[model samples]
Target: MALSTAPGPPPPGLSAAKIVAYLHGPEPYLLIPDPTPGTHQALVRWLQGRQAVAGPVVARTDAGASLRWARTLLALTPQWPGTAGELLFVEDHLAKVVLFQDPLLAGHLSAKWLGRLSDMTPRQRERMEQTLLAWLEGGGAAEAAQLLRIHPQTVRYRLRKLERIFGGSLRTPQARFEILLALKIHGMAAECARLRHRAEELPARAASEPRRDARSIGR
Candidate 1:
């Protein structure tokens, strides 16, 4: 589950004050103090929002466990000076629990990982996503073309373009994993964005449209 550091309600019956008290109570002593609050805050934010540990129990040591988990995960992250990020893939949290953070893994996955998609024409990027997904689905040009509803020649041509863009990564196992996983994550994020957009429109939609006469609107 995704973790959040936004300081929400703690487990039920657990005094809000108790949780609040611990929030500032040396949030698990850092392995090293971040030079600025950014990096540290990044880590703390990453740690937040996990499914509440079972509630109403005082025998827990979650504060320390969370720190330990953070240390374990963040320890693998490479520090890019002056950059403001240390992202954790909550989707991969369970599968990647023993996994150390990969500071640059996003790069291996897609151009969009670092907003590099902005460099590509929209059509080019769209084609790239289609081709990459088909490629990872593990097939030759004919199969990819079938999946994309395009000509085999088109698939092969796009593959060539992708080769230029991604180098030998299409053939590299680890790189393939990163690319496929990243694409899945990117797709999930986009879907979430669409949902949120629709949600945002709901309030406006209601306000702009006529209110229903309940009796006439439904049985």
Candidate 2:
């Protein structure tokens, strides 16, 4: 069953079975059986209201693993570097979760596919990566142009450049899949860097803010 760990009384249409008492604290979990679309939406809304996140459905015996998955999802939230949300669902990001389970492997895969692009300027690299990923996802310049909101000719130009860099690698199915996964990992890494920068700035930002004196509160 899926689990939500928002601290509060359970919502309507939920039963006693939905509530799981935690061994350590006042916080409780809601167990969702058979997460239909309606139920998913309901859980999403409930969690959103509480600014919480939920883990994927697993057998009751796998509750510990489910909580581990939830913590992983949490680590990717807000300042955690990847997706930020009031209520993130594991089902929506299963592929990413699976892909990131081994970050060292993911890093190596990204380096294998994207290492050459590092020589280019950031702007040049961004454009090429976006165009290439879109092309890979859409299977053609026209479809990729639509996805990127660029002209087909522009996509064609980028693809030609990419062809020179990637050569016959893009023509094979396995290589294409690997390149696509690598590009996604690269993007996630970029997001992580940005989030880390922002997080580092937080302490300095807080220290710079003026503190109010306790005696001034009643003024």
Candidate 3:
């Protein structure tokens, strides 16, 4: 796979038959031999048709590395701002990918920054954590309020509470960085947990659903 900046259909000279496309499990993959800008254009069109989101197309020199890179991008999809079906590229989120590449490291950081806050009730902790992240990312109470869809006064209230819990550490650059990263990691972790629960229920869901015969469906 090769990365191309162009977006649209394949050039007239590029034959669709040359691109080998197939579905592996729930993902659709394409193998374009001697992939060029035109090939990538075609791929963009194909993905758009299916309303799919994908990772950056990596070099084929190491198939294993390519697969791993793709999986990493997919795992971090929850952190991205795009809605379902938008074509998002890994290039846009390289920093986050590196920051969260190691779950053990991310978990450690999350614990370090959030351990005290976790002692609070689940709902309160959630609100505080979200407020902290919004404040850090937005840089002010008004901006944070817009992000959280809450009143500016409410944001100030949470910030005051967070300041008491976190103390002057929130004033420091390094602590703020760690807190932001930890909060983001926590969000992604929650998404992963939900996906796991859904996967575990997949078999039961399939069994519970009625199946139709191929012939009967066509009749």
Candidate whose TM-score is highest: 2
Give the TM-score ranking, best first.
Answer: 2, 3, 1
Candidate 1 least-lDDT 10 residues: 50-59
- CA-lDDT, candidates in order: 0.52, 0.73, 0.69
- Candidate 1 lDDT: 0.52
- The clash count for each model shown is 6, 0, 0
Worst 10 residues of 2 by lDDT: 76-85
lDDT of 1 by residue, 1-219 (tens): 112222443343333223332344323232222123554344445434331111111224554544545544433333332234434532345333333344255434444442445588888787788788897785678888888898889888888877877778678888778777777656644654575576467667778997778687755
TM-score against truth, every candidate? 0.50, 0.68, 0.63
Comparing 2 with 3 on TM-score, the higher-scoring candidate is: 2
RMSD of each: 11.8, 5.7, 7.6
Q: Which stretches of candidate 3 lie over 4 Å from their true place?
A: 1-34, 37-68, 74-89, 92-96, 211-219
Instruction: Tell me the TM-score of model 3.
Output: 0.63
At residue 124, candidate 1 shows an lDDT of 78
Q: With candidate 2 superimposed using the best TM-score fit, by how many Å does residue 186's alpha carbon deviate from the native?
A: 1.5
